[model samples]
Target: MGSNRTNFRVIGLFLLLISMLLFAGGCNNKNNVLSAKQLTDNTPLTVKVLDVGQGDAILIRGGGQVILIDTGDVPDRDKLVSFLKSEKITTIDKLIITHPHADHLGGFAALVGQFAIKQIIDSGQITTTALFRQYLTAAQKKQIAFTVASEGDQFDLGSGILLRVLAPGKPLLTGTDSDLNNNSIVLRLTFGKFSMLFAGDAEQVEETQILKKYSREMKSTVLKVGHHGSRTSSSLPFLAAVAPEAAVISVGLNNDYHHPHPSILKRYEKQKTTVFRTDLHGTVTIAINGENYTIMREKGENAK
Candidate 1:
């Protein structure tokens, strides 16, 4: 009788262990797969790379949050405000000014009162430009929380989406033609299996630094071409490290500086990267659903 009881107890314990393993397996499977309905739900992460001529302005909306990256040039102030209004964006949860460049943050002062801004993020680097000071003064007057971004800083945009800073390391880099450009806030946003890198005017030095520190994390689905696809920004090593499937260059049509140098275009073509330019494709929008994403353009042929 005693032996029989011991045998029964052992068998029951074994069954319990098997049941636990099966339950864990089921949970893993559920997490690994998503139904078509879930993937095609009404809400999906949307990133709008606004066509602010010769400047950078990207609007990201997801998980009940809205983030504005840059404000573009002074002339784009009305355009940016109108676009935000059209989207029914009453408040900006996070406003990231990559740098103080006129074409990047020039419209910031004018936009200070446009939206109910929660926080303002800037690269710690300082400049004496009048535009920069104006932006700073406006932020102060508004009493918006200011944050200086650093490498490894992460901003949670909910729904498992995270924006991580990869550049402007501590102590600030120097010796570059434009330290502000090189120190631009480099951010990488990841949503499930999808990822996009916003390389804010980062040049070779900044790229090399980031590569040395975060080589594994550099690969992304989309890349915002640095410095409007300037030869000085996207070096061969940088391109190899990023390995972006798609590239977007925010440049004006037929403006001075002859932006998006032909050689740079050739480099992207060699990599077989689908290149889209703001000049060519106005306001490129990428709607992300789980690991899948759809790229839409406002206008023009998809090109260099």
Candidate 2:
């Protein structure tokens, strides 16, 4: 009877160990891509076009990740910080500087100190401004990972969302009127049936290159208008190739540059693409769930 009892105890111990092992294996599968049925109303991707006034700043949140693209001009320093705090964004997974222009990169110094930024993706373009130098120094001091994004790099944002680099391709442009603006890092983000193209202030030269090589790939559900809708960018052919259903322009209101040029607005109208401007519309938020999306503007109505 004593031997039989001991045998039963050993079998119980073995079964307990098996149960523990199975539990651990399930926990380890966290990184697996979400299946279709799993993409219910639980997790939705949110993209916010912050009203930085005369610059670009886009916040993308989904899959438990936060991505920031560009930091508006220097004057937006405090406002940007406040916005982040309001959103409860403590850490930034990725910070992408489309270019070194002041309007696009001015808030970098403040951001480095404000949040725990893990990685920085640059457009591989150089500028000799004081702010640019300070920005680089801060990143170096923090020892954050930095990547000079090339044309074909892809970033997995988990949960079936992907960000693919589409510009700053081989043999970078030269002899252009503004080399810096032309080489801005362009990105295309895809989540299920929805896609958005970020055209970081890219002008005609850059737009021409993209349409020439990847016109077919330019199609997107949303397009962040290039160069704040300046006449210098957003060529008709380029816009036609993109054929976006919606366009968002990040620009200031009645300040120095009269952006979202009238001609450009006409072009978008011709394309039958609804337009949203951060200057007029305090902040534009686009929430996406699978193939459907909802747009909420904090300020003005859709551009007329």
Candidate 3:
């Protein structure tokens, strides 16, 4: 009887050890599954066009670099910051002011205060408006590396991603009658066979200038519709020149500017290009890999 009791105790102890091992193995398996999911979800390149409503703010992530183009107006600063945080961006490699327009540069002051800015690029034309002056002051105090980007200037951010300046061949005279919208900085970004054009509030005059200077069609896979799709921009000739598969217009809903004019919308339809609008869809993100591109809207579904 003593031998039997001792054997029974040993068996119970073995069973407990097996149960503990099973529990630990189950936990480890669960952890491994979660890690695999996370690895699959992370994207290599992401372009997020934040919705500031009637303003422009686009974030580009590629080749281990982050580039921010135009912060929206003042009221949208918090939202922009939140979006950056959500994306796990700790510093800005490049900050580009497309133009001196209030809507484009209004949030720069706040952004400079919030994050580490490595460099800044602008048209380098000072403005008389207080908001514009504030942006200049903040940039100066931060001692952010500054440069005036001209047509043809190119830089590589990583993974074969290239940003090429495409507008404002020369600085415009300050306080001149020439429309600021026409002087807006245009950028063309290319990754492999996919490319996108960001025309910052540029109007017909600027488009005409680009056409004359380049003497080539502005072909891109995606086109950020100019002047928020106003009738003043996105000329039919320019549209034909680009021949993009997709177009995005960043504008406000019910804005007084009457942006995304019906005429412009009809023109895009005529070309059979898919159109996305921030005014109606909120933030729009475009992800490109090699020759493939995918678009995701904040309010709508993703399209590839």
Model 3 scores a C-alpha lDDT of 0.82
lDDT for residue 212 in candidate 2, whole number 0-100: 84
lDDT of 2 by residue, 148-243 (tens): 997889999999889999889877788999999999999999998888999999999999998887888889888999999999998989988888
The C-alpha RMSD of each candidate to the native structure, in angstroms, is 12.2, 14.9, 12.1
Candidate 3 lDDT over residue span 172-241, tens digit each: 5234344677778899898887888998998888887787776473798889888888898999788888
- 91: Cα error in model 1, Å: 0.5
The CA lDDT of each predicted structure is 0.88, 0.88, 0.82
- Name the Cα RMSD for model 3: 12.1
Clashing pairs in 2: none
User: All candidates' TM-scores?
Assistant: 0.86, 0.86, 0.83
Q: Which residue pairs show backbone clashes in model 3?
A: none
